[model samples]
Target chain A: MKILVPVKQVPDTATQVKIGADPKGIDTAGITWIVSPYDEYALEEALRIKEKQGQGEVVAVTVGPERAKEALRSCLAMGADRALHLSDPAWENADSLTVARALAAVIKQEAPPLVLFGRQAIDDDMGAMPAQVADLLGWPCASWIMEETISEDGKSVRAGRQVEGALEIFTIPLPCVLSAQKGLNEPRYPTLKGIMGAKKKEIKDVKAADLGLAADGAQLLVVALEALPPRPPGRIIPGEPAEAVKELVRSLREDAKAI
Target chain B: MQIELSEEQQMIQALAREFAEKEVKPVAALLDAEARFPHETVKRMGELGLMGIAVPEAYGGSGADTVAYVLALEEIAKACASHAVIMSVNNSLYCDPVLKYGTDEQRKKFLAPFASGQQIGCFALTEPQAGSDATNQHTLAVRDGDGYVLNGRKVFVTNGREAAVALVFAQTDPAKAHRGISAFLIERGTPGFLVPKVEDKLGIRASDTAEFVFEECRVRAANRLGEEGMGFKIAMGTLDGGRIGIAAQALGIAAGAFDLSVAYAKERKSFGVPIAQHQMVQWMLADMATAIEAARLLIWRAAALKDAGRPFGPEASMAKLFASEMAMKATTDAIQVHGGYGYIKEYQVERYFRDAKITQIYEGTSQIQKLIIARHVLGAR
Candidate 1:
């Protein structure tokens, strides 16, 4: 029972995001790239499932350029048994659908009982891969999954999402797509033994051509991007306390329209 | 010469930084205020293979070199200096010597568990009389049948109260001076061993400084490290490596304080603008950055030398001397940058200021390092 996990690298949450000279991209200078936060939960859940079964492998796959190998390496260090890297230059500028095509190819080849993804790649917040890849693989998709239980024989899963103070539950058969949410489980840091041994673990190259795929799928086109303007300073509603309250209410209903 | 870190080193650094920032930093202030030893985190460190970073996996270690060890240590120190010293003492003072000098059998018992951080270990060399003159020994170990009966009072021993093993130095042949000293691995709760007192420290209070009393403590001959009368040499060799670790620690403390000062300067306003806009504050930050870089380079050179199997005693000494002094200066300037807010405990630069002071005094004092450098410079022993 192998659980396949697809991950994407994103700018560290702490880094200041600056729009690049190219409107479609971001400034890469001095940016510290990290495995996306929710994706960490996805990989962590895969590892947990393998450990719970006591006899299984957790395979990680990533679609990115050369630097994306570091992302796969991080997964391996966090106890993934093996990794597949779609590092062909063709994948570098691929849209979400094309990346999903590569992932679906790998998932089909691996034939894992389950495939997992972060709800969204934080870099772009697209959250498009799970549905796109599920359509490609002809599998049921469970998005924003918070809790899951595998049936005794591991043929199906009962998944749930927290919504409006209630659990929205669904039953999906094995060989399905599940996108992880924050409340799923806490991710563990890479242990010393894991890091030392990660180098010896396998990360096989996965060429785009080998997957019978071309980077041509574009369901959505991104236009020019601009930074959000800095917020203006708050204005003081002056006068006596009672008059100030009257003025604040008038401003909220009129100029601000916040009330 | 690729000055950039290798992938492995970066991984180690990231792991350590995460642990430090998420786990250690949150509790650092409470640990310092309470002066409680960080037992939980220390045990986890052992589990993480931090206690034996340089020790090989075959011997229950990370199988990393000194560079990785320093990188990890500096990260921990940047969050909390107490955790840094706890790690440094275990890695350089205890596990390191045992791995280097102990036989394969001794390594299995003495080095393995300590390196894995299952149990704490301490170095027992400093006595009340043997402060600067480490050779002046009052403790004595008399040869008895298959082992030696030891009697000694060792002071200022880090990790002493909690340690499972102690690497003790005593004069087996007093007439031979420093040459007469022999090192022994003594386990806690072995008949006559006692921890009489734990010291109240000025800084790094989360770590224990204890007084160890050995009364007719019988140690097995197999527990002895290296040849007889080789204790002083082993101690010196161990301190050389220990100094490099301390140098890295000092660098982290300074760097950590500098980081705080920078953030504070950017936020703290004076005369209707951020203090960072002032040239005086900028100059201070620039000086701290320059000093930290210098200290880091020195530590790296020494660590690289050690990894490449070269003599690095004088270089280690230089690193310790310069880095410790730099830490003191940087932390002080950090406090100044914070103004009255720095005086408060919540601001944390005061804690850094206190932690930085010990880096100048412990492992080997900055003055003693100067002596070692002078001796090396004159081509004299």
Candidate 2:
């Protein structure tokens, strides 16, 4: 069986974000980039699935500019067998669906048994890849997948998904898309040997045009972005216990609208 | 000049950093308070190829360079100095010497296991009477046919208790003074070789600093490392690399403290505002950041020189001296930045302050480093 993982690199969660001068995006200066934390779950699940089967290939694919190659390399370091990077100048302004379409094109060529994705990219919080890619391919997909197992026969998938307050189980057929949720699995750190091996193998690059797709012309344009307004100052109720409690409750309900 | 780490180096550093943050830091205080060795994390480190970062792959090591080793060591040190020193001893003190000076046969035996992380190794050089005056001859190895009978006491030996093998230095010819010293690879469980004591320390309390006593111990002449008088040269060269590890550890300790202070200053309020807004606190934070960067550069230069196979003795000494002193000053001010909270055990800056002192004291004290630097600059012994 061949498993493919689609990954994205985003700013580390620890970054102090500042709105860029253009007001449409955050400042990129001094920001450290990392594999999206949720997507890290996707990589972990793919690697784990490969380990359990004991006989399969794990390929990681990504669609982004040159910097996205680092994310693929990181996946390789984390024990992915191969990396396929989709690069194109037109991809610079492509919308979410365009990116998904390009990935779907690669998916068709590889024709892997399973494709794993993070439920959402932390940067965009779209949570749209599995649905978009699966819709493009006309295959069944389950998003927010928390638990999964491939049958011994390797012809079907037993998956558990996150819901309002409980798990929803589904026995989906073979060759499906699954978006990993937080509890899917714990990710492993890239070992030293794996890192050296990651350096040895070359990442295969592909052009969107070669895939017979127009990468330009985004479907949706991002309007002006706004920074969150500064928080109001804290207030201390200046009274003893009895009056302070009443005043605090009154202020919470009437002035702050918190109650 | 900016030092750029290669991708492999960055990954190794990141792995170590993640390990430190997730595994080492959470248990650091408990381990320190209990004075317990971190067996679980150390074992994981070995498995991750951190224990033998600079050792070659052929000998079961990760086969990276000195720069990579220091980068990993600094990250571990940032979370817990104890873990850092344990890694440092195995890499620099035990595995390094055996790899460089041991024959292939000896390498297979001594270097492979430690570098592979299956076993730990230690250096037995600092005896009760041989602290700064390491030339003092107290340990003896008397030739008994093709083997030798050894007797000595080695103190302040890092990783001494848990190490599977020890590289012991002893006097073979009394008249030759320091030249008489011969190094031997002695495995644990050898009859008459014993760990008589383990010290409870001022800092890095999680690591075991032990005293090994040898009485009527026997070893094959084949176990000897290099020529008999070459022991002094081996020990000095080993310390050169060991000093670099210590410098990185010191830098990490200070960097860790500075991070705490910076985060604390932003949230900790005094005089109706965050302490970070105050001029005095800003000065402290600025100085800490600048000193840490400066210390890191020195350490990088020394590590780079070693990687390039150039002479880095004086440079290593300089790095150790400056970084250790800077750690002291940085940790002190870190505690000062936290004010009353820093004075308590619940806060971490106090621990950093305590841990910083030992860096100045061990792996050749700050004074010793200055002397080496001074001697090198003056072209005098």
Candidate 3:
């Protein structure tokens, strides 16, 4: 079985965000990059499935600028057999639809048995790409898959997902798409040998224009961007243990109204 | 003593555990069975700034504190004890002494490679007759003109077969007894110094234990650590740092055993319900958890003291004694919880049980720890 995992590189969100001076985006300088947190889950699930089958290659695909090679290289280091880079300047400000269109063209060409992606990119926190790609591929798709198992005959896969406060298991046919959720499996780190090997693996880069995508389709568009509201100042309440607990409960119920 | 780890220390523990489980654990058993070092894992750890965790950044190390180093060793040891001991000896015995006492030239030449993991190191103090009686050294270092001629045999030297440099202890003044000892930097392949044999050990099988014979091994006087009569102090101080590493190793071994036992208890069934439902099994887990927490607190307290430049002699001894004993008991009980499956090698609890015994023996035996602690308590030598 051939598996393809689409990974995105985004600024590590856990780090303190340095808002751009313009207040519309993040400060890019010196910000570290990580494979989209959700995407790591996706890659891990794909690797797990490949290992269980004991056959086939787990390929990685990414749509980004040239600097994005670092994230792709990391995927290979983490045991992905091959990588495909869909490089296009148009992708810089492209919305989810255009990005999905570029990936769909590559998927059709590779014709992998399955496709996987993270639920969202931690940077944008959009949570839209997977479903968009699945729609573009015209295949059965499952999002937020917490557990997955392929059938003995390879005809179908069963996926468990969180829904409405419970886990709902679904069975989907082959040639499907899956968006990996957290708690699926732990992702492996790249070993020194794996890092060395990743440097040698071929990364095929094709222009979005070459995939018969229209130049206008590649046209970048950002309607507007704005900063989120700053979090309220923290308040610390100190008192006796029981009194503190009671006060905390009162604040949550009356002030925050979270209870 | 302050028993909590700083934020940096906690980060090191998390990072090391992530690296070991993801990069090292997959191959630990295979490498141990084949008696092969996991070179790739070690190299990767070096890249992650782990090998010389406690070494200062100025000397090609990560400059992390003692607690961080201890935490990192614990994670690595949980995956493979052999690699952990190698790391411990290099950081505590070889690189640390040079950084603490060496000339600028020596730090640049000898300390850099070991700290950066470009080369390995070993510590040679235990002669065949001087296992626990460390002061009774038979090795001799005689001044011959501008150099010192070293002649002796060092047995059970951890990492001896693979080390590029060895911090060797020899008697420089027999009349001074313990104060007579002096340390020398013996580079491997020095003329007249040879690795005669590597011992096959019951545990940490992947780590090479070898004997060295030094026959008229001439080293420049510049290589001596500190001054005459400083070897015993160097050896003891080195072991004080080493004890923390051993304590961390013990904690890791116990953790590995405890995790496996917990999983087994929740799944394995004897009388319809899961084995974890039994009261005795619950007691074992509760005791293990409580002991492990206490052990971690003590180990961290000692590490914090060392980092703070305080004398941690007593705390180090106490932590080592408690953690090693805890590991022995925990691994044995892990086997008991597994019942018959634990008796076999396939289940791996038996291996953990076997591995846990050595932590108590090496890095000062449990008896020696008691002596140190009691001496500290009574203000006696």
Candidate 4:
């Protein structure tokens, strides 16, 4: 099986996202970029599925500006067999559908048996790409997959997903899309040796035009991005354990009102 | 600066962290409290090629770079400082010197088994009276025709009680002083050698630092690491690499402490919100994060310089000095952040605090590192 992992480079989760002066995005300067947390899960799951099935190649595919190469390089360092960088300036402000369409066009050329993506981009919280890509490719799809097992002969995979207080399992055929969620096997960091080898591995690039792609099917356009409201300063009410518990319950009921 | 780790280093980092988190952390307190050598973990580390990370493949080692060694050591230290020290002495002190200065035959005989993890190795340099002043070695090695007769006592030797091979340093000629030192490879079964005592320490008890006596121990002349007077250079060189390992270990301890503190700050609510919301708490976390990053950068810089075959003694000393100090501050602050829970062993920050103190003491004291840096800066003899 040739597995494709669609990745996105986002500010590290440790970063405090700052609203850009342009009022449409987070300030990018000095912010460390990491492969999306969920994409890490997706890449790891794909690698595991490949390893378990005896033999297969895991390719990470990402559509972004030049700097997205860092994401691809990191995935390659973590033992991805190869990488495909879909270069396009048009992708910067493009909607989820545009990304899905671009990924679909590029992935079609490689023609892998399976494709994986994060359930959502934490920055945008738009969980639309995986379904859109599946639609474009006319393949079965599974979302929010937390657990997975591949069948014998590498013909199909069974995935377990959490859906609104219920667990849903899907046995996706060999050729399908999977959007990984939390609780997948823990992701592995690229080792020193892996990082060195990645430098030598061939990273192929494909233009959006070459892949017969454009932003025609954009489902959503981000406008007027806003920062999360500043959290209230903490107040420490020192007391005994029982008193502390009682005080906490009272505060939850009276102040936050969620209880 | 381009801060990319090699693929092998990345894998080693992941593997080391996984192995440490899963296997070592669970037993760390038990081993430290019992002061028992982690024989099983040591064997596992050997299986993973951690025992001889810098020893070339020709000597049955993993042939990894210095950065890879530090990365692995950091992970191990994050799990258990004792194991980290054992690993540091093996790869940086004992095996590395043999590979660098030993004759080809010496490398095969002395380095192979240790690198393969078939036998553990220890370095003996610190005498009862000397540590930072290693030149004051009181151990004596007398020329006896075809061999050298050794007699001396070395203290604070990590893995001393259990090691199968020891790179023993001694004053070969008292008249020549520091230049008179010589290194000899003493096999474990050598009749006259004995472990006189094991230290009861505040931390890293599981590693077994011991005092060893060489009472007329005899080794073949061919076992000498270099020329009779070259021991000082060899010892200093070994420490140049060893300091980097220690720095990495310190960084790991600090990082571990910082990580736990952050989690606690986010989850442990105080008055009306999680402690993380308090500006004071946030400032503490921010400082911890910044310190860790700075130390890591310095550590990596030293490793990179060493890998590039540049002069790194001053930088390595700086890294060790800065990182160890950073660890001390970070671990202490971590405890403060945890308040009552931090003082108790039930929370891991206390152990981190205990572990952090050693980084400032061993490999080289932070003060000694300052002297080294001063020497480099002032061109002091």
Candidate 5:
């Protein structure tokens, strides 16, 4: 059995982002890139499945520029058997549908028994790639998956997904797609041995053209980016406790009109 | 003249930083307050391959170079100096010499488990009377049949009570003095071998420093490291590398204290403004930053030299001397920056100050390091 995990490299959420001069992208200076948190869940689930099976391969696939290899290397360090990096200058502005199409092309070639993705990339939060990839592959997909287990014969997968404060369980046949949610599983830090071994592991880079991807066209385009509004200054309520409470209530009810 | 870290080195640094911040930092205060050894996190460190960072992979180590080891050590020290010393002692003091001098069988039996962190190991060279004068070993190992009968006491043995194995130095021929010393691989369960006391230390309180008494303790001849007269040479050579580890630890302590001081300066308001606005505070911060950078360069130079299989003894000593003194000063200034809060345990700068003192004393004292460096400079033979 083979499990494929699609991962993305994004600026760490803790990073202080600055809008680039173009206003459609973020400035890359001094920003540390890490594997998207949700995608870590996907990779962890895939690794767990491979371990449970006792015999299988976990292949990490990423579509981006050269720096994306760092994310792939991280997955490899976390015990992925190998990696596939779709690298090309043309991929710089690819959209969800185009990325899904490129991933579909590679998935067709590899024909892994299971495909996994994060519910959404934290960077864009579009949450559209997994469904689109599933559509392209004509495979059943279970999104926002919190728990998962595979059958003994590896012919089917049972997954629990987060849905409106409830868990919705789904059983999908072999060769299915799953988008992992936050509560799926805790990801392991790569061991030092694993990190060393990862250096020797194979990472096969495929060009965009090799994956039958075009250079110019993308279905969805990003136009503008803006920072969130700064928080308003806090006001201190001063007086006796009873008087302060009265004044605070008066301000909330009358001046601020929050009440 | 390139001074850039390799990708592997950078990866280990990042991993260690994350581990130190997440695992060690959370429990550091509790461990220090209780003076309790962190068995759980130590085990986790072994599982993470930190226990044997530079030992060969075939010998159950991470197979990293010395540069990687120092990088990781510095990060660990940044969060908790207690954890840092335990890791440093294991990697540099115990595993390094064993790998360098142990026979293949010895490597397989002794080095593998300890380096992999499945078992713990300690170096028992510091005796009650033999602190700075290491050559005056009183422990005797007389030849008896296929092994030797050892009798003496060793003090200030780090990881002593907890370790399963020990690398002990003993005199085989009393007349030869330092040249008479021989190294032995002694197991914990060996008869007449006991860890009689665990010291209450001023700093690095979370680690166990023990005294071992060997009363007719028998050790196998095959367990001997190098040769009978080669022990002093082996010990000195090991200390040369060990100094690098200590330097990194000192560097980390200094860096950690500096970081806290800077943060405190920005947040602490005095005279109606943050203390950072004051020129005096700024001068201290600048001095600390400059000293730390200088010490770091020295450490890196020593580590790179070791990695390149060059002579790094004097450089290691220089780094140790400078970095340890810098740590002491930086930690002291950190306390001053925090005022009364730094003097207390809650802010934790006091702990860093305490930990910094030992760096100037151990792995050959700052005085000893100067002597070594002076000897190298004068080309004494």
Candidate 6:
């Protein structure tokens, strides 16, 4: 049995993002890149599946430039059997759809029994890649999966997903796509042995053009970018309770116009 | 020469930093106050392959080099000096000498479990009268059929009460003095072997420092590490490597204090503005930072030399001496930077101050390190 997990490298959520000089993207200077937190859930789930089965290979795949290899190495350190890095200059500024297409091309070659992904990359918050990839592959997909179990024969999977204030469960066939949610499972830290072993593991690189991608493959484009405005200072009503209440109501109704 | 960390070293350092911050930091103060050993976190460290960073995978270790070990130790010490010393004694003091001198069978029995973190081990060398004058041994190991009957006392044994195995040094032939000493692998719970006391320490209170007494305890000849007369040489060589670990621990303590001082200086107000605006405070911070960086460079040099399989004794001694003294000074100034608050337990810089003093005294004192360095220099001349 083989499992394939698609991971992305994004700037750490705690980083203070600065607008790039070109006004097109976040500044890369001083930004530390980490494996998307949601994607960690996806990888963890994949590893758990492999462990439960007693034997199987978990392949971690990614689409990015050279710096992106760090993310792949991290996955390897986390006990991924191997890594497939799709690298090319054409991948720069690629949209979710373009990423899906490249991933679909690789999935066709690998033909893994199952595919996993994070519900969304925190960087873009564009929860579209998993569904788009599933569509391109013509495979069934269950997003925001919180629980999963595979049948004995490995022919089907049952997954429980978190909907708005409700639980939605689905039974999907093998070779389907699944997106991991936050509560899926806790990821393990890479052990010292694993980190050393990762250096010796094989990381096979593929070209974007070979995956049938082009510079014009990106369908989404950002025309402008701006930082959110600073929050307004607070106002304290200094008076007796009744008078303070009256003053607060008046400020809310007239000055701030919040009411 | 280039002084950059390899990617693997950087990765381990990052992992250690994250572990220290997330798991160790929250409980450090509570553990110190209670003097409770962090068994859970130490177990987790074993799972993360930190317990045996430099040992080979075949030997149930992480197979990392010494540089990586020092890097990881520094991060752990930054959070809790107790955890750092516990890790240091296991890696450098116990497993290292066993790996170097023990036979293959001995390695499997004595080194594997400890290196894998499945079990703990300790080194017992200092007796009541044998500290700086390590050559004087009051412990006796008389030859008996197929084994030796040991009778003696050892003081200041780190990880003593909790360890499953202890590498004990006893005089096999007292007539030969220091040359007569031999190292033996003694298991806990052996007849007549007792941990009489667990000391109440000022700093690193979370770690156990015990005293051991053996009365007619018998250890098999097969358990002896190296030849009978090779004990002193093994002990000295082990301390040379152990000093590097202490240097890294001292560096971490200084860095931890320096971090708190910087944050306190920025927010703390004196007269009209933040104390950071004062020239004297700025100079103190500058000095602390400079000393820390210098000590870090020295530690790295020693660690790198060891990894390269070169003679690093003087370098290790130099690093330990400078870094230990630097930590004492830095922690003292850190308290000064914090004023009265630093003197209080809640500020935690006082704990760092207490921890710093031990580094100057253990694994060969600052004075002893100077002597070793001088001997090397004169010998080379």
lDDT of 2 by residue, A123-151 (tens): 87988888999999988999999999999
Once model 4 is optimally superposed onto the true structure by TM-score, how far is the C-alpha of residue B170 displaced, in angstroms?
Answer: 4.1
Model 4 quality (TM-score):
0.74
Q: Give lDDT tens digits, candidate 6, residues A1-259.
A: 7999999999988899889998988789998899999999999999999999999999999998888899999999999999999987777788888888889999999999899999999987998989999999999999999999999999999999999998799999988999999999999899999999998998999887777666665678888789999999898889899999999999999998999
**Chain A vs. true chain A, TM-score per candidate?**
0.94, 0.93, 0.85, 0.85, 0.91, 0.95
Per-residue lDDT of model 3, residues A49-71, tens digit only: 88988998889999888868878
> If scored against the real structure, what TM-score would every candidate get?
0.98, 0.96, 0.65, 0.74, 0.97, 0.96
lDDT of 6 by residue, B1-381 (tens): 788999899899989998998998788888899988889998899889888889888888899999999999999999999899989999999989988999999999998888999888899999999998899988999989999999999999988988899999999999999999999999999998999999999898888999999999999999899999789889999999999999999999999999999999999999989999999999999999999999999999999999999999999999999999999999999999999999999999998998899999999999999999999989952
For residues B1-381, could you state the per-residue lDDT of candidate 1 as single tens digits? 668877888999999999999998999999999999999998888888899999998888888889999999999999899999999999999999999999999999998888888987999999998977899988998999999999989999999998999999999999999999999999999988899999998999999999999899998888899999999999999999999999999998998899999999999999999999999999999999999999999999999999999999999999999999999999999999999999999999999999999999988888899999999999898
Per-residue lDDT of model 2, residues B1-381, tens digit only? 666899899888888998999988999999999999999999999989999998889998987989999999999999999999999999999999999999999999888999989999999899888888889969999999998999989999999999999999999998999999989999899998999899988899999999999999999998999988888889999999999999999999999999999999999998999999999999999999999999999999999999999999999999999999999999999999999899998888888889999999887888889889889889997
Ranking of candidates on TM-score, top first:
1, 5, 6, 2, 4, 3
Q: Compute the lDDT of residue B36 as modeled in candidate 3.
A: 77
Q: Please list all clashing residue pairs in model 3, or write none if there are none.
A: none
lDDT of 4 by residue, B8-92 (tens): 6766776788789988999998887788999998887886678888667778887778888888888888888888988888888
Candidate achieving the largest TM-score: 1
- The better candidate by TM-score, 2 or 4, is 2
Off by over 4 Å in 2: A234-259
Residue A110, model 2, lDDT = 94
lDDT tens string, model 3, B119-221?
Answer: 8888999999998999999999998888899999999998899899999999999999999999999898899999999987778877888999999899999
Task: Tell me which of candidates 2 and 3 scores higher on DockQ.
Answer: 2
* B328 Cα displacement, candidate 1 (Å): 0.9
Interface CA RMSD of each prediction in angstroms: 0.9, 1.0, 7.8, 4.8, 0.8, 0.4
Per-residue lDDT, model 1, residue B275, is: 100
Best by DockQ: 6
The better candidate by lDDT, 3 or 6, is: 6
lDDT of 5 by residue, A141-259 (tens): 99999898898877899989998989998889989999999989988888888888898999999987887767868878888998899999999999899999999999999999999
Candidate 5 lDDT tens digits, B181-216 = 999999999999998899999999999999999999
